[model samples]
Target: MNLAILDGGTHYHREAIYGDRYRSRFDRAIYAPDLVLADLEDVGLLIVPDRIDPVLLRRHRALLDDFLRRGRTLVVLGGNEAETWVPGVDWAFRPLNYWWWLDKDAVPVQQLVTPEHELFRHLPFADTIWHFHGILLPPTGAKALITVPGDPGNGDLGGALIYEDCVTTPGRLIISTLDPFYHHGSHFMPAATRFLDGFLNWARHIS
Candidate 1:
């Protein structure tokens, strides 16, 4: 499959992650403004990283829909603007809990909903447990791979952490609220690097 990524050019982390580390694996890095239909014509899998401007995506919404109609795959990671660009997504921002792991009895907030899914073969459930920026109330017919349980005290009315949607469009959509690349590129979170190591490998070979 021809794998590509949409680089927004606003953040250095994106270049650090995709340009330096995984440059050889990807076929193209189309700038967000230049995201025309022809740019995605030969792409089999497109990775839309976090921190990309939602306005650009909204401007090219039709182009994206057309790309999906051709049976391509789209992988969206992090950011709270999914509901503005992605079809059938209901995203809700929640307060971040960066220090949750500092507690002695703290367990991972994320739950593996589909433990048997092929993604787990590459990325273990433990690798996906970093703090999330928001939650996704998955649309009908979507398969939620990981979820966070509701904790009213924390104002975390829990929802899907990651999900796959095949019914909404002809192509497949893999969406996650985890900003692994940003954290990984920043060199602060080892788990984010672990996530990218497994997730990029899985994206390359996914059938």
Candidate 2:
């Protein structure tokens, strides 16, 4: 499967994303323009990070929408440099890095929800991923994944949603607004192993 991480041209370098075993799992991980033209017909998922601009997004909206329309999945990450994605669908990483700790640490337990859901079935991820920087979860229908004091940058419960059993398309589609690639490959709790077990289990077979 061609898993593309939309980089929307931020200062965040392309090489920095290396070092994850998951890297090999992806037949190819690329950025915009190139990603836009790749045939999504055979692709399984698109994991975007702050990528979506009028030019690119407008050009590829049909491509992206068609992918989702066909039941494919899309994940978006948000932070300071996020401004390109379609607004209502986008969430912001609040003030603090809830998952990443600068001083203290938080415990991680499997607060699993929707186990029957295909994505979470037999997966290995705490109910809450170590929130380093997540979208400023909007104030509406987005589901609640993690509750807090709460952290300003809370990951939206709903934005992580995948419509698998809905219309003519029985496929799955998800849009996330946080960077869950285990940045720096630190393999720390709520960081590395914390999320890998779950996501990788049912991961689309990448060539």
* lDDT tens digits by residue: candidate 1, 11-33: 55465446567777677888888
Best by lDDT: 1
For model 1, the run of ten residues with the poorest summed lDDT: 10-19
Error of 1 at 144 (Å): 0.3
lDDT tens string, model 2, 56-160? 665666566667666666654434233343333444344555534455565532243445555666344453355544343333444434333332376434223
- Pairs clashing within candidate 1: none
Instruction: Tell me the TM-score of model 1.
Output: 0.92
Deviation (Å) of 34 in candidate 2: 2.1
